[model samples]
Target: MGKTTRDRLLQTLASAFELPEDVVLDLTRITITGNTQFLMENHRGILAYDPEKISLRTDQGETVITGRNLKIDSLFASEIMITGSINGIQFIRSRG
Candidate 1:
């Protein structure tokens, strides 16, 4: 099956079950707590990391986190936590 077809099936299931699309598709979920911390779910891995910038790979594409004094506080199989002065968050979806 192709990505498009798989995506369509997921969408249909999500609708039928009234479930969140992110959970169904294993998509990235990000939560920011003020400018002091960041939390992400379903991240593939870290693409790049530094004090000022962090890039993460995800099912949908890429997630870029920009901040100051960024540091990964905790890492799990599909989750992450960062402590820093977060300034911005950007997403770049890959062409499928």
Candidate 2:
């Protein structure tokens, strides 16, 4: 298949799995709507990296996470590592 076709196919698959395009392309970081944050390293998805204050938004409510020094390690493609204390996590969905 062509590069464009292949890219589209990969994007479709990634979206279906709630993954971002950067993750598939082995990018550095993938931020969705500035709400959902994803750190890419290898080929895995690690959620809740922030420890001091991690927030996530959904259509219903939000999640707050609290801990300590929040950080992501070995982030390359779809793999990420979170360190420090998990302060809180929040989830909020945007209405359009």
Clashes of 1: 0
Model 2, range 8-43, lDDT digits (tens) per residue?
A: 788789989988766584433423223234332333
List TM-scores for all candidates, in order: 0.92, 0.31
Give the range where candidate 2 is weakest over 10 consecutive residues by summed lDDT: 30-39
RMSD, one per candidate, in order: 1.3, 10.4
For candidate 1, the TM-score is 0.92
* Candidate 1 C-alpha lDDT tens digits along 1-96: 498898999999999999998988887788888889899999999999999999999988899999899999999999999999999899999886
| The 10-residue segment with the lowest total lDDT in model 1 | 23-32
Candidate with top lDDT is 1
